[model samples]
Target: MSITAATGVPVIEPASVPVLELKGIGKQFGAIRALHGVDLTVRAGEVIGLMGDNGAGKSTLVRIIAGNFPPSQGTIRFDGREVHFHRPVDSRAVGIEVVYQDLALANNLTAAANVFLGRELKRSFGPIRLLDHRAMETRALELFQELRSETRPHDLVKDMSGGQRQAVAIARTRLSNAKLVMMDEPTAAISVRQVEQVLGLIHRLKEQGIAVMLISHRMPDIFAVCDRVVVMRRGEKRADKPIAESSPEEVTALITGAKEAA
Candidate 1:
């Protein structure tokens, strides 16, 4: 059922048509099976928490969706159309952006520069083109403001804190006009205040109608923002339920393999 988001926007219902769907997805690394017969679906404006213990194949599943590699078996549907994603660019071309825990920002680059790293704006005059630093800075400032980030756009990434680094990585999605944003361990190491800000940003993203797949170990984060929770254990999906229908202890049990399936 639909509900109002934190920002007063309509939240997508769990039964809505999915923005991305994985059917019988599987992955194998020679003799090692990384994933086995997994099924998942994410709808627009929905935040899904992909939860699991270590070695549960969460990374393999996300990598497949991010187009880091081809799935060994199964089909992927994007916006209701079947698609094969063979490369990272293939995923990016379709508005799927992943922000890993590394943040992946250039240490010496300014936040604005990092935001527009490879996708910088250019101004040309008779074949004489130059990077539009001012435009990028302005755009970055606006994006940061939207996320309620206090970090300055001109500050070097090396000087930014964990939350700011995460913010910068997320801002890149805005530059790419992302439709589905997947974050891995967004609040793994950060101050409590910073975590609050980052969580707020996730809510803002939902208000903007962007689908989010949050892979965080923080149960509070999942409870705080996720509309649905999908749990994986031993390379298999154990649970997939609406957040409203499950308790924190129940999800924990599912993750720890105390519960068989959802």
Candidate 2:
């Protein structure tokens, strides 16, 4: 029920303070309502699977959380404090990191560059400032080592495999010391070996007490790591339960809106 951090930090589960909580989360575009009354809770050191069919409002909800736009009809609570995300910067400032399927790495940049991205370290020389590449690379290597990844810090993202790119993307979150990471379809298109690596990386994140929101259609991926699942259908949350008490069949039925028949 409790896990220690990667550096042996005693991780408090945030039992009284969930990392993120949503209530009556709704989104509307013109006359079309994309989401209605959606509720979700993400706890520290836990991996939560967000499963829903296409057109099920999963994307809408994620965008809202990522600060793509403000929710039209709900409240967001982070670390027991009420908050509003009007822009992506606001979300990032609060240690909320979202890694989409694209990985979002600059293809031409080195893994270390991408890890720091906009928040690069600088060295000063008589009022002149330059990027401290060596420091960034060293830090990047340390992060990868902590994740038990074999990725090279100086390697170009374009040259890396899909799984390797994902590793770098996930490492970027650690640069900001993120508390919660939302992975959108993490294992969509990758080799079997790559999938295993990414799944192992998720376990590492959880061990470090970083809450994870894993949004994937792959049942095996969900079952492999998720502690709980929230199933959505037609823009509304249909079921939320612990992994131990819920089966893939039950989740599938809830997602497909076939619960009654099943």
- CA lDDT, every model vs. true structure: 0.92, 0.91
Q: Worst lDDT window (10 residues) for model 1? A: 8-17
Give per-candidate clash totals.
Answer: 0, 0
How well is each residue in 1-262 modelled by candidate 2, as lDDT tens digits? 4666667666656446889999999999989899999888888999999999999989999999999999989999999999999999899999899999988789999999999998999999999999999999999999999999989999999999888999999999999899999999999989999999999999999999999999999999999999998888888888888998889999988987889322
TM-score of each: 0.92, 0.92
Clashing pairs in 1: none
As a whole number from 0 to 100, the lDDT of residue 169 in candidate 2 is 96
What does candidate 1's lDDT look like per residue over 166-240, in tens digits? 889999899888989999999998999889888888998999899999998999999999999999998999999
Clashing pairs in 2: none
* Worst 10 contiguous positions by lDDT, candidate 2: 7-16
